[model samples]
Target: MEMSNMPLGGHWVLVIIMIILATWVIYRYLAPQNAKEWRNAGLIQGFIIALYAEMYGFPLTIYLLTGFFGLEIPWLHMRGHLWSTLLGLGDVGAMIEMIIGLGLVILGLLLLARGWSQVYKAQKENRLVTDGLYTYVRHPQYTGIFLILFGQLVHWPTILTLLLFPVIVVAYIYLARQEESAMRKAFGQKYVEYMKRTRMFFPEIKNWKLLFKKG
Candidate 1:
């Protein structure tokens, strides 16, 4: 079948499934508790919708690239892997990028799960969580979110998603700061000291091994 004539869109079922799965994972693990967290989660929800809509429901990005920009690209679903297509990597290259993206998504999920586990335990004890993923970054959940979003971008670079990526990043950073402010009020000097010792998002290079360490 010709790439242009191949079934390129109307996969609403797949899109809905992806959105539901992504949103479920986000809410289940992150468990946004406040308005700020909810707002950030909304942004992620928008991102997920835009991503899958383009990935399955409609190839708007592909359409624009080939139609508006006059790029000589095919309209096949596989050809929608723009990064691999643009990089001239072909099918093998697309597979490689997909693998890398999947790896990142898995890592991000692990971080979210581990961070939630530690935080849930600490909350039960009414103490600050400063072990496991928390020992590395002050906001491992946010870090995981970034990783997941970036992984999706790497896997499929759609126009809408590419634009939304940085906006989501900024929103999460703001939300993280707001959460930290509340943490300071709740934990006082202890949180202040933790902030001093730990980075907000990224972990220190030397402490990278702790991410693999089992608690």
Candidate 2:
């Protein structure tokens, strides 16, 4: 029952509800720290809005697939689970993937929340956040965002999202570099030494012991 193809057609009300829920989450957990932070937040919000809008209000990718690419699957427009439909994964397989995706989203959000908590406290104390998730990845928040997007892609796999995903990743990489420059100015040699130990995004398995100890 949970894996049955979604009801045929879009649901504007559901889309609006999801957007409102997302807005509240961003407001409560991801409040921006400065002009640059606010701009980054806006960029993500814009991407999410476009994502969900098409997710429930309009199936643009499915439309393009059927309209231009000559997809002839009957009721393709009705079932909104595009990934399952496209891959011929029955409802059960799709449900399993959905569960994994949800777990990934939860893990990603936890990392983001924990990183934010540590950073907020560190900012107040004028101390660097090198413990917790930062012990491995210099940018746990960005890593978290990437994980979240990846989970979404696992379930959705829309062409529009696939195209935007790389662009968003590049943007975040550029933003992370800009952030590192400021950190260098603020912490000087200390920050440089930290960089030598930590990577920008992915965690070093070699530092797993350090992260476990610090965490």
Number of the top-ranking candidate, with TM-score as the measure: 1
- Give the CA lDDT, 0 to 100, for residue 17 in model 1: 98
lDDT by candidate, in order shown: 0.86, 0.74
Model 2 spans > 4 angstroms off? 1-6, 72-79, 206-215
Scored against the true structure, residue 86 in model 2 reaches a CA lDDT of: 68
- Candidate 2, 32-103: lDDT as tens digits: 777866776666676677678777777777778779999744343334556676678756656767788777
Which pairs clash inside model 1? Answer: none
lDDT of 1 by residue, 106-127 (tens): 8888888888888899989988
Off by over 4 Å in 1: 1-6
Give the CA lDDT, 0 to 100, for residue 59 in model 1.
87
TM-score of each prediction? 0.92, 0.85
Candidate 2: lDDT over CA atoms? 0.74
For model 1, the local distance difference test gives: 0.86
